[model samples]
Target chain A: MPYDKIILGAGLYGLYAAQKCGAAGQRVLVLERDPGPFMRATYINQARVHMGYHYPRSYSTAIKSAHYFQRFCRDYGFCLHTQFDQIYATSAHFSWTNAAEFRHFCRAAGIRCDDVSPSRYFNPGMCDGAFLTTEYTYDAQVLKNWFLTELTKLPGVEILYSHRPDKIEAVGDVWRVTAGEITAEAPFLLNATYAGVNDIHAMLGLPSFQIKYEKCEMILCEVDERLKNVGITVMDGPFFSLMPFGQTGLHSLTSVTFTPHETSYDPVATFPCQQQSEGRCAPGNLFNCNECPAKPASAWPYMSQLARKYLKEEYRFRYKRSMFSMKPILKASEIDDSRPTVVRVMHRNPTLVSVLSGKINTVYDLDEVLQQ
Target chain B: MITNKEKNFVSAVVYLHNDGGRAVEFFRRVTAVLDQHFDQYELVAVDDACTDNTVDSLRSWAAGQAKPLTVLHMSLYQGLEPCMNAGLDAAIGDYVYEFDSTAMPYQPELIFEAYQTALRGNDIISVCPTHTSGSSRLFYRVFNANSHSAYQLRTDAFRLVTRRAINRVHASSENLPYRKAAYAASGLKMADLEFEGRMGDKGTGRLALAADSLALYTDAGYKVSAGVAIVMMVLALIELAYTLVIFCAGHPIEGWTTMMFVLTLGFAGVFAVLTIVVKYLSLLVDLTFKKQKYLVESIEKIQK
Candidate 1:
């Protein structure tokens, strides 16, 4: 029989949704543009499962995340890296939540919080208050494999690797999905394409979303000594982190506010939804996706300056490789980073469910979104 | 003899189910908290047919109290939903405080603050949870997201309700198997007093309880499943269109026509059967639990 649901994008949100639907006895098929999972934003971003420390301005957002942090641990504990204590220290400048307010929020949210002596942790002049949180990081590859294994165990679930959906049509009450020469039809269609959400919507002649993409880069560094798996984050401002990068001894140094390239909707303006924009690369209107640099441009030096300010032993951090990524964020979440997974069902056609993916820890939100 | 002052008294309803040693401490703490807040009040403790000495401990504590004490014992272990209904029926107070006996040593000050919040034109004052089981949190989100009713769900089991709100909850809960669901859907003006709840001593079948309550009150999962099935059947009609187009276009693949026909028909048949099964299953559950919605075996008043 034709699959009951066809989910586009095999990112964390898409894979998680497929597993949930398949378990519920719905025949599900997941299509990934990439050959495998975690080739895009899911792989390149800082893997910290936020626990209300990042968002001090939005209480509801902080509290909702508190639930996600615990839920992620309970559901996927084996895939998590808890080798080091994750600290949320407030920087001296451009900080949204100071030391005292952040501590109060942690207590109200029922998160375990402990104060760290400035002399003992971080550069003494870099931060005023340093506190420990229950947040942890997960290896993207391990998480991807875990989801894929669960999905394969289900009877009618199928994963189409490297299948790029080029067309989606609302044929009568069901959706007809066309990828390359292959065609599939399902009653419900969930567009969880993340950064490519607007791309599919544009192809289907649907209205555009208030979503934008930012070219982000993470500076991977090789530390002389292991940091005891402790992931460090300095608020949401221009700060750097020396966190355990998966199972490797190397750490991923990232900044929320700083990136190699300025955040843009499209580097090449022709295909706005494709996020491939070139700046005066050709004589005519011929656009090229390769015009944009695939690797980070001078991301290491900038990261090193911020790292030195925050860490006492900055000299131990050696540059490895910078990974370039596109961050898909809602226009609203750009301010406070608070919007969770939003399932926008086309009011005219309720059969098509478009899920704007949020935090990685909240992958379970797929169950709730599908139910809606 | 009930005096004019005691006639319109505040009532505190406590639920004790298999809670053994904590019952006496619970009674003492509840009464002490009540005395500091109200001039005239009564206690209505519902014992859900405990096998332990919880009833004896409660009875001994009631003998020493001057305020009115009523204990409603169920003939069977009717669970918290029905036990709450019985307590609500027996409580004759101007306002009512409903909380679990194992609710961590609730300071009288928070109770008074809740009362004051209610006095300031709020119909319902509830203590919201700072921490709860992950399943319980998911239940609230699912219920709220799918709920068409006006009442929004909260994670607070501890509540102080005015007489009007209490009446609304009682009236609305008469037909439902879940009391908290009914109360949330009762269309009452409610406000939450945020508090970090301590974990209870006993680990009840909370996951099962939450699932059962959600299925009874909000058929969110069932509705989504049925909707999905209906859409699938509709999609089968569209697949029929594709089959014809491909056939007329002289499809390259052999036996494609028969495969499409069987696939379309088979999915439609499965969905039709699945929808019917879910419908009847919901009815069966409702009919089975129809009698136990508010069943109370006996009630006894202990006073000097």
Candidate 2:
């Protein structure tokens, strides 16, 4: 059946966009490569609802995140977990931004940042400063269930799983998209397949963005009671972050040095693992990494050692398993460490909107384009 | 392809400084040796604020290799010791190799040989050249003579150490100004392998590092200060005795006894102040060595 909007990849952005379009009385069709929504980058991430503390160097991006942070918490309050204290720290060595600079940036961005004792969470002489900040994590499963229920109840919205567009062609004022035995046509097409944004653009004969791909690993572990009520992030350099993974009673341990097992600078996400995937994944058609057989070995040893170097001995964690995903980063934002949610109108007549963002709270950036 | 290769994770950390013309060649040789002998190995090249294209050359060469190559860029032109300390801190391996220079005068097989030596109950194995420069020989002689540690100093090209040695060294001190000294002082089993080749030139700021190490790991500085303090105190006592003898012999000059008494008091005060100053100086040294000392700008893993 023909629809007013066809959203590709049922991630947070795609699902949220579908809900908004449906609320505006527009018929929407959602295509998901995975069997369910939030199966890829959305669920396999740090799950940090950024409140501007992560980016002290980029003022604009931090300000924007601070602005959207409140709205996302209020809208998705059911899935948001805010019972624990989140701490941001600056490493004593190799840190780009010192404690003073981070505090100044926080004050300028109008965020709550109170000075806290570094010895409370970190080993002596490891971190220069620690601040208690206000940041929360979202339960991806709860959010996914909410989206599924809302979209199922809302009229004029259809979601098809395991459907990826094999072909996309602009015909007059509509996009004709086909995947295997399914075909759909829509006046507006949205490409919300983050890591696969360039791949989709290539298929549409549009210019690809200058981006790099990292095969990232987020390790889930069970933390001790001492660390159960806290989230810690060592910032501005190569450090580690240990935080609660939503409300699941587990912690996600990630390190800047060990999280990314491999990197690909190609226009599309390419890796040596694709050769061993046995048709399960490829550069053009990216597949799920968490289920891939050729995934890299767990970096738990390196990551845990790094965390232990900074964290106190009382606060401990045991590894459970690893969740893998592909992350795309804009080359331009590397200098200032800013993650900007980019929404580009690739074509005006057929209205092909390609949305690429690293942070989850920035999904609201799609409202301006989707409403127009 | 050899079916039997070492399965232990190895990390080779190479230090670079204005060696742009030679870094690619060095990396190629080292990686070839590592690949042939080890199943899992990573190369960590430390860019010590090189004023040349060393990092660029290494990065370009690393882009084609299958194994991972991580480049650690120092924020400033820190000398070799601190840069290598940072690199070692970043390395995660069961066994780590410290390559102090890019000039590999010996055969590549020697790299694996050092690892094998390290596996044979020796926590630290340093690969050195048979002949060393006259100045280095003299420096080692002086350092070993004054050093309280059992291990002797040598002119080594590279060294291989197990993870246990690294951990012990870290636990012993927060700042590793001189890694060779720290490893030697760690009291772990150490051996030296000598090859028939000439060693490369020392890294930048070698003299200052040499001085710092001597002051830190040896008792020469403390001995010299104590000797000075003792000689000054003895001279003050002798002068006071001479003044008393002159007064008793009826040949005392006007106000000479008073002058001698005041001089003796001054010397006693100076002796007490000197003792306190020495204590303060030692405390300062302790504080300096108990702080984090390296600053890295960034660490980048080259894409294969």
Evaluated at residue A34, the lDDT of candidate 2 is 90
Mind giving the per-residue lDDT tens digits that candidate 2 earns over A1-372?
789999999999999999999988899999988988999999999899999999998999999999999999999989988999999999876788878888999999999999999888876556779999999999999999999999887799999999889999988989999987998999899999999999899898799999999999999999989899999999977889999999899999998878988889999988889999999988878989998999988888678867876787789899999999999999999889999999999998888999999999999899999987
lDDT of 1 by residue, B173-292 (tens): 434456666666667777888775644432465666666666666766578667777776677767767677777888748447657776867777687667756765875667455633
Task: Provide TM-scores for the models.
Answer: 0.51, 0.82
Name the docking class for model 1.
incorrect
Residue A287 of model 1: what lDDT? 19
Going through the candidates in order, state the TM-score of chain A alone for each one. 0.89, 0.99
Q: What C-alpha RMSD does candidate 2 show over the true interface residues after superposing them? A: 3.9
Model 2 lDDT per residue over B1-304, tens place:
5579887888899999889778899889998899899887788889988888888877888888877788988889888888898888777677899998999999999999998898889999999998999878887898899997878889999999987787678666667878899899999999999899889778558887777777778876677667677777777777678777778888867446668676777677677657756755875675576554777777888746
| Residue-level lDDT for B96 in candidate 2 | 93
Per-candidate clashes, comma-separated: 6, 0
- Predicted candidate 1 versus true structure: per-residue lDDT over A1-372, tens digit per residue: 477888988878888888888888889888886777767767776777767677777778788888888888888887777767777787643455668877887788778889987545564434668887777777888888898789779988998887877677887767888887779988888888776676667666677677666656787777765355566777745466777776656688886544525444542212332332434222112212223443334445445645654565533678887776656677777567676677777534427778776578767666765764
Candidate 1 TM-score, true structure as reference = 0.51
